[model samples]
Target: MSSNALDQFLNENLEDLRSKGLYNEIDVVESANGPVIKIGGKELINLSSNNYLGLATDELLKEVAINAINEWGVGAGAVRTINGTLDIHTQLEKTLAKFKGTEAAIAYQSGFNCNMAAISAVMDKNDAILSDELNHASIIDGCRLSKAKIIRVNHSDMDDLRKKAKEAKESGLYNKIMVITDGVFSMDGDIANLPGIIEIAEEFDLITYVDDAHGSGVTGKGAGTVKHFGLADKVDFQIGTLSKAIGVVGGYVAGKKNLIDWLKVRSRPFLFSTAVTPADAVAATKAIEILMSSTELNDRLWENGNYLKNGLKQLGFNIGESETPITPCIIGEEKTTQLFSKRLYEEGVYAKSIVFPTVPQGTGRVRNMPTAAHTKEMLDQAISIYEKVGKEMGLI
Candidate 1:
């Protein structure tokens, strides 16, 4: 029998969430997660994927993955420290380092795991971390895992960061101080002020870490935000994921040779977890190579993003201040936002609603991710559906 107290706790919290309309019921996709997807036997113009460059279903990547599987079989067999460090894994790391213009790079099982492993490996109870208010959940968990003194700086507010850095440094109560932030804020699509942050980091002599997961393929002409700002060599740790724009699975940290070397021996995930499969490593490598070779897909992605934003803005939707392709159509109430998403699904669009805990309360939004694979026709149809639903729901 199940533990009664555990069961009761889950039941009460779940029912509370349901009653408050905050419970998110996930819809399973019946087809490939591409520009279009099928769910429940119905087709949808998918605007909810992180496949920003549309390489997830690229022909060349699929071919490379197949070849890799043929050569390396399925799994890596053991944890990286226990002889699971395959040649393909090494190749991928080298390619990532080159792509990010870093001296070396270390790959992890997943982006979330990368954060969990990398942060705790270097920081501990004696250190302090100054984090942006809206950093990703993984970053938050990673900081907490480090058992460091976490100081929250206001989102994109360099002034707050500077003040906190000053305090953290002047106190001299900590052995080390680190400033970490997302290169691109996923929710609002705003870019971080890396120049200002770097200046402050230099002033305070603090370590700098930038998680550019959403910015890798979508920013800097596909190089990333660090390269975009010409600060590639300045940031101590450059974290990214192969799962998003790269069109595969895994995460990585690109930095100086010494840093990567330290993470390889110290990061818990790298030491204890088996490496990504041969296919995943090769596919991710191929994706990065493609991005490095050409910016065609990146251009297409920006075009689509601008096009979608214009259409929604013309339709009188409250599209937030997103400097990147990740657009959020702000719809005030939580239940209303969910209803709007449901209406969108019914009308053949698969954009999802994001509410509190994911975002702040009463600032619910239908987040739209426009990828490179999307055609103008699909976007126009989605916009038309938005118009119909917005009119009927009196949202526009």
Candidate 2:
């Protein structure tokens, strides 16, 4: 294709995004992403970060990262299949497996890449995958890359999943069948029906995959959704990220030893891409250790989440049914949702607007991530802002 043709296509797509009100304007976060952040020279109570445990700014994690840098230097020189598998990497994986109560674990450079690597590595063109309709974008892309026939079941609808699983298995149209879902749906903050899904998977003998990105740090007593329901051994593939609850950057899959071994050899990101930095690996390992030691952070996180959710509900905002630390104040229109977010920013809260394509068209929301570090004072201040902005916009 000519360069001008490609340019025209790109321009048209950009215009389409703008017309749909889906073009995101990037904000420059001037400080570390924490409970409070500086953006555009204005400080605001940040409710948009994934640092659920507040580990990103934790002195312990920072000290560990710095010490690792001093000891191991800055980067891993090559991919894990090459010379990049440092001792810290193995330690982190082992620590993760222990933390998650799995036999083994394999780490990827990022949570998104973990999906891209693990999904395609295990399931191929001759397979069929039954996925949740509300799964993360990474799960969708990973399913596509697998070249499997993707069947999206209704969000958390056990009957639909069971029906599809049976149909896929009976058809014999593929070599394998797998069911995948996000343990906690990020947008709605609702927990997946994993216990029901596990029962269906057992009935159909289907491979099981759960991306517990949101649930890892927030649910199941800090182990995750699998542990929450005592389905650890029942689920085949358990995926999580070090970035969210662990307060670092990286992703992992924990399961049987064979599965981790298989991913180490077959997952493209593990085999081909440069590995995570020594600092990141070491820091993530320490974070896991902290999580294993106590449920203090997790307890605080839930308390704050409940406080915020109750406050929003009492103020008459439509806070969705969330079972985790994630809370969403649903507004039905894209323009209104964006305006609401803008008003919150002006009033000094930093929750961002999530709109169509991310969620369904009419389910636009301002998702709030209440962390362990948020104090009662902070929660009160945020609720006050939410009420003021919501009332001003006639949303409450």
Candidate 3:
């Protein structure tokens, strides 16, 4: 029989989560994840995907992916350090370096693995990492895996970062210190102050790392956050995901050639884990080429974002401070936020509610992600549904 202790622990925690309205119930989409999705035989205006530029469903990308499958087959069949390093993989890395304005780059199977691989490869128990409190969960796990002394700094507070950096340096207890942050805070959707952070990094001689998973295609004219602030040569580690804006799978680190070389040798994930599929590599390369060639998709994305934000604001909803396209409509309680999302689903919109644990308590919200693929007509329909649901629930 299965272990009773383990089963009991899971059952109790699952029950607790359900009772508190914190447990998430995932929905399956029958159709492609595009501007609209089919869930349980009902169509919805999908405003909850990370497919920012809508390249996931682009005809060009789909064609390239099919070509790649025909040419390279499906899988790489080995870890990167083994025989998995295909020419397309190298091409993808080179394109990523150019796209991010970096000297060289390396690829990983997932953005989470990029962190899990890169951070531990560079840091150790002898080192320390100063991280923003609002950074992504992947970042937190990566820092933990490093076995470094993880020091939490106040979110986007330059003074607190400087103070902590100074203290960590002055104590001389650690051999190296790294300050890591997200280029875009995903939940609240604010850009990171890279210039300020770089200034402090210079003063402290600390390594700088920016995970621009949410900022890459949406910011910097589609180059990324590092290039957005013209600090391309200043930052040490630039991390991004191919799945989000690139509309494929995998992640990468763009930096100096030596750093990438070192990671290829030392990063456990690269040495042990299999690389991304050939189709993913080829599709991502084509996506980056599209972004670097033009900003049409990026512009359309911003227009849709602004249109939706204005619609929600005019209808009397609290959208938190978001400089980027990610918009969150704040609902005070967990249950209420869940109810709001449910009502939205019933009204043919598909934005999900983020509750406590993902965010702080009493600050739950239904996050909306508008894509380049969404037309003005689709956005208008979504806004009308939001208004209908909001008024019925007394939210607006």
lDDT of 2 at 216: 93
What is the per-residue lDDT of model 3 for residues 7-95, given as tens digits with 9 covering 90 to 100?
99999999999999999999999999999999999999999999999999999999999999998899998998879999999999999
Q: Show where candidate 1 strays beyond 4 Å.
A: none
Clashes of each: 0, 0, 0
Between candidates 1 and 2, which one is better according to TM-score?
1
Candidate 1 pairs with clashing backbones: none
Which ten contiguous residues of candidate 1 have the minimum total lDDT? 74-83
Tens-digit lDDT track of model 2 for 240-286: 99999999999999999999999988999999899999999999999
Q: What lDDT tens digits, residue by residue, belong to model 1 across residues 1-396? A: 999999999999999998887999999999989999999999999999999999999999999999999999989999998889999999999999999999999999999999999999999999999999999999999999999999999998988999999999999899999999999999989999999999999999999999999999999999999999999989999999999999899999999999999998999999988899999999999999999999999999999999999999999999989999999999989999999999999999999999999999999999999999999999999999999999999999
In model 2, the Cα lDDT at residue 324 comes to 86
Estimated TM-score per prediction? 0.99, 0.98, 0.99
Q: Candidate 1: lDDT over CA atoms?
A: 0.96
Q: Model 3: how far is 165 from its true place, Å?
A: 0.7
C-alpha local distance difference test of each model: 0.96, 0.92, 0.95
